[model samples]
Target chain A: MRTTIMPSVRILIFFTILTGILYPVGITFVALGIFPYQANGSMVERNGRVVGSELIGQGFTGDRYFHPRPSAIAYDPVPSGGSNWGPTDARMADSVAARRDAFIRKNGVPGDVVVPKEMLFASGSGVDPHISPDAALLQMERVAAARGFDTQKSDALKELVMRCIEPPQYALFGEPRINVLSLNLALDALEKGYPPPF
Target chain B: MITVSELIQLMLYALALFLLTPPLGKLMAMVFRGERTFLTPALGWLERVAYRVSGIDPDKAMDWKGYLWSLLSFNAFGFAVVFLLQFFQSSLPFNPQQLPDVSWHLAFNTAVSFMTNTNWQSYAGEVTLSYLVQMLGLTVQNFVSAATGIAVLLALVRGIAGRSTGSIGNFWADLTRSIVYLLLPLSIILSLFLVSEGVVQTFSGSRTVTTLEGVQQTIPLGPAASQVAIKQLGTNGGGFFNMNSAYPHENPTPFSNFLQMLSILLIPSALVYMFGAMVNARRHAWVVWGVMFFLFAAGVTLSLWSEYTVNAVTGVGGGMEGKETRFGVANSILWSVATTAASNGSVNSMHDSFSPLSGTVAMMNIMLGEIIFGGVGAGLYGMMIFIILTVFIAGLMVGRTPEYLGKKIESFEVRMAAIAMLLPSAGILLFTALASVADAGLAGLNNQGPHGFSEILYAFASTAGNNGSAFAGLTANTPFYNTLLGINMLIGRFGVIVPMLAIAGSLAQKKITPLSSGTFPTDTFLFGVLLTGTMLIVGALTFIPAQVLGPVAEHFLMLNGKVF
Candidate 1:
């Protein structure tokens, strides 16, 4: 307990302080300092009011808002679930087929409609916040018609969807996915009288 | 044993990677140590804070064994901590989103996954982990886990280079400094850079924004930058977004792509030089760097050549499926090389979509033990096994006592090294064979017959090697995959590590020997080539027949434009 380099008592205290206390404290402080907003779960704001975090996806079934990938959690942060059900799992296949069928029926589209696969299968985490542009496009006409906008206006909205499409990092890794949540935010601002396209 | 078609595709990718690692590795070491940065002053602030927190005193030297032990223990503690978090997530604080309690099997998988730095992620990233859990649990572990890897490598270098010295660097100091000086600042800046490139950096929840069609849209958000930084820095592949860094906001621009690529290989590449520096032999580092370069370049060229070659049959745009048009073949090949070489399994491009041959090369990186610039600490240590083998083999050929630097190679050292090297190869084979026979396992196969067999082989290889990249097509995370992979990751890493520690302890007690006429030359160009050959031969010999049975048959089937 009395060694010169690091006493046993000191060793216990030092390690406890270092790993249990300091390591967590250090990262937390840094996270708070640098990405305060993100450190808070990327909650979106509207007119000084708080909203959800940007990291978790939400459900929007009625062509009212762009939908995210299917999730068992549906944006719950704890107990984050995955549709880890295998491709052949009748339950998984059924859920996906149901989603596919519902998606088609709601939009009055055929089975072969090019809805992105990401939108049908439950994401690894049931809480994916983005959808494919193709999936978003699936609902464009429906949403536009419901909004009493010109049928032709769907094309421009699809372009806006493309505009918000996040390219691959380094343009090399991963399938291209549009953050349905972010694009919808831009759309909301547009609906409420925001100016030219971003 | 992998078919020529598969090997050829892999060779193209490897060739490019071989050219890429040295510069990237060198630059990363430099960057983490405070060399080149777009914003220098701010990075300095980050470093200072890290210093204060880790309580690093520059003057003290750490005993080699203590350092290695601390490195492993820290990770072991992390697993415990993450497990506890999941075990008690429903009762924990700041879990505002109110996620569910984690299941035991999946939680166990998560614990081993992150602690091992494989981050295989049986559960999805966002839903399973809370803001508190993500920031404090996974993200923190990412930094420390990476630091642990770097520190161990530093200790090994000391073991090799120590003439009569009894100690290596302090584990606490290295871990602290690594996270503070290397990982922290780099991640912060890289995070900001990613944000600037349009990656989201806020904690905003689902936003109800209206689209042109008047329908409301929701935007999801959380702490991305911190995780993004470590994901690449640590070479750990679990993503904040399920799509991982491939999500547009996570990696938005071409420039960000370059940054991510740079981040993935940064610490690993630099640690090679550090190896050289610690051993007092810059030439030794160069030799390792060169072999890594040769192998990496071959992978790149093979990948691109196969990608560009179009399908040997069918000829339908080379089936270059799952590739981002924006980045092209070059980025995919480079990413594959960097990720596989370093044990970072995060993928932007799906290996599943690659030609049968291209996928084989990528898989080979894991089977070869990823010493083609391997992971931060793990890669270097794995390479040291080969280094020991090279010395011993050469010594036997010449009837001389094997020596590295001043350390005499002995029976204990060689035996331990053999264990360290043999475990991963054994892991891939034993597990793959078990999987091939298991009906539950065979049910996970997506592609049929040989190619399907390759999928199972690849899963175990990647898991057992402590390399987490997947073939991506197989349905992992069932009780079968979850349990099997969890066991593999645990045994693969510690299986080798326990042996590694034994070797270290044994070597630490040995008296240093002076170089003599009969001593094997390890620093020359010829030896470097020999070491590389030894590594590849050992890898191919172990995995080739299985590969031939798997992807090889699939390749011919594809070339003949038919499924097996």
Candidate 2:
């Protein structure tokens, strides 16, 4: 027992310093050195003021901006989470129906066009940065109309949406999606006649 | 209903696993054998320094009792440090968030969870733990607890491979080698990659940013990438944040998601091959690996089918509730099965929102004891227990004595294996029953009816299997859950470990018998089938009634458009 206790305590202290203190702190240095922009939470800036992280979505309820997915925590990164609504839960159905109706009313889409499920459901991370391409496309007309874009400008905006569409990583992983924060930022840049954000 | 592109991605994942298994397994085998490797030039000095500072004589071997004593005492010390740190976190440095100290029961539960490698998080991490406590208490335990599992497995492997040798191995040496050689290098690489994918790694406080919509958003930032890497690689599964891998900063890109999923099973899968290399039974290792992969693929397939199908009750196509848009259905289902199968319970999506049968598959994966790739070191040993039982049963049918890896499988070995198998099963069922009947447990549920019942059963199954992913709907931070689940984590972890170590000791003393015609062959395809059948039968028999009450009933109720 004495043999076990002495070595156990010593080793625990040693590893605590090595793994707990050194390893993470060491990675911090490496990350800051190699990927400073990313390691610093990938914060996007506008006119030298920080707006939001490029990887984290912001709640976009205004008609002028393309909305991200429904957020359970209203896109709060501080305590991110999903609705965790079971598929069989009545509340889940109610929520989805409510979101669907809101999507149709807000976007003013034709009754024949079905809203994407991604637009209706709350994302797993309330701050999920990206939305499906279809979800993004569905909101493009609403965004264009709210910004008072004519047919030609709306066509240009559609082209910008296409440009903002990100392919899957290495073209073989995940789904093709668009980052809402980056896209909206790009939209602002285009409206200001400035260079695109990305 | 799976698309061609989704099917292609799944195939690519399988190919990556198949391709990477042997080399990583070989590297681990070399590390355990104390052979010179490519990493020896750089890491050898650190290993020596570790041994010298701790007064651990690398050459001094320990019998099973000595090894177990060392392991328990070390883990006990670890638990104290974690618990104490949580209590004093408000005064601790690096708490930029200025979070308050944890409650006593939650602290106790967390300490036990991490030390046991269960990582059943009762509290949301971003809201609770200081950076110092997260790093020193939880992250340190992540590395050591995982190394501890590997160490125990190495000891058992030595027992099987030894020729009447009393000593299994030195606990300190095995633990050190596992960390220094395998876990550390992989973590460094993966953490760096995760950072490049936008996982934050800094010593800063949460930043307040005003969005384009003119709303203030608090963005949580820390040395998250480093912890996220090890949490996956070590199969520890505790999230730095509440949403775990689902959070954008924790898993920033599709590439990061793919890699994190790969890392979850990488160590556990490679350890199967390490067991082969150590025991000089390559074919037998392949047999065990085959059984694990078969079950794992089946779970993924079932989950994909269920998740992709339209929900009857909710009238939603693709069951996208609680799933990220980037991952969609296929990637999310793949992660659900992989995380559960590996006992790496970091979720990219919430299980509570999964279609009924998909949730059932995830629950069943844990309830099968997580032996489908399982946790680092723990998975293989758990599988070995089932193998021993299978051999015993087969021997009985054939009217011959059972033998495995050239050693006779006698009554004592079989008894230890049975105890190892029964303890977790009994803990899961009995605790679930208690939680169901108790007001304290019933109050924690987020959904009503059968789905609510699943939240309790899944909580116990997750804790008892030492798989930490939750339904997330079970508000499990109360004193009642914290204490009971904490106790169950111990019962799940040590209950299997203590008996397995005893079996190693007994097996180490037994003389090896040469294989004969009468001896049952355990390294063949037939044996793999038999082993798979035995595991399913045992798991199904014990948990079927519980399953019928929870996920199965929910599935049927769901089909009839009855929403709870």
Interface quality of candidate 1 as DockQ = 0.09
- State how far residue B563 of model 2 sits from its true place (Å): 0.9
lDDT of 1 by residue, A50-144 (tens): 44545445566556566666665454434333432221123443565577788888777777775555555555434556665677777776666
Supply the TM-score of chain A against the true chain A for every candidate structure.
0.84, 0.97
Across B1-564, the per-residue lDDT of candidate 2 in tens digits comes to 777888898998988998899999999999899999999999999899999999989888888999999999999999999999999999889999899999999999999999999898897889999999999999999999999999889989988988898789999999999999989899999999999989999999999999998999999999999999999998989999999999989998888999999999999999999899988999999999999999999999888877777777767657677888778789999999999998788899999889888988999999888999999999999888999999999999998889999888999999999999899988999999999999999999999999998999999999998889999989999999999999999999999999999989888988889988898887899999999999999988998898899888988888788887
Q: Write the per-residue lDDT of candidate 2 for residues A98-194, one digit (tens) a residue.
A: 8888888888888667788788888898988888888888888999888888888788888999998888789888888999999999998878778
Measured with C-alpha atoms, the lDDT of residue A153 in candidate 2 is 78
User: Fraction of true contacts reproduced, model 1?
Assistant: 0.03
Which prediction has the highest TM-score against the true structure?
A: 2
Q: After superposition, how far is residue B515 of candidate 2 from its true place, in Å?
A: 1.1
Relative to the unseen true structure, what is the C-alpha lDDT of residue B190 in candidate 2, on a scale of 0 to 100?
98
Give the Cα error of residue B537 in candidate 1, in Å: 0.4
lDDT of 1 by residue, B1-564 (tens): 122433343344444444665554554455434465544555556545544544555446655455555555556667777787887888987565677888887788878888788877667665676666676667766776677677667566556655455666466655655765567667666766665545565544434554333344444456566577778878887777665654544654456666787777666766787667545677888888888878877876676666555343333333323444334455666677678877888776666556667777888888888888788788888888888898888888888788887788889888988887777778778888888899888888765656677778878888877777776667776888888889888877877776666666556556677677776777898998889878888888888898888776666666664533
Query: Residue A53 in candidate 2 has what lDDT?
Result: 91
Task: Give lDDT for model 2.
Answer: 0.91
* RMSD after CA superposition, every candidate: 7.2, 0.9
Instruction: After superposing candidate 1 on the true structure, give the runs of residues whose Cα lies further than 4 Å from its correct spot.
Output: A1-196, B1-73, B203-219, B308-315, B318-330, B443-448, B473-475, B506-518
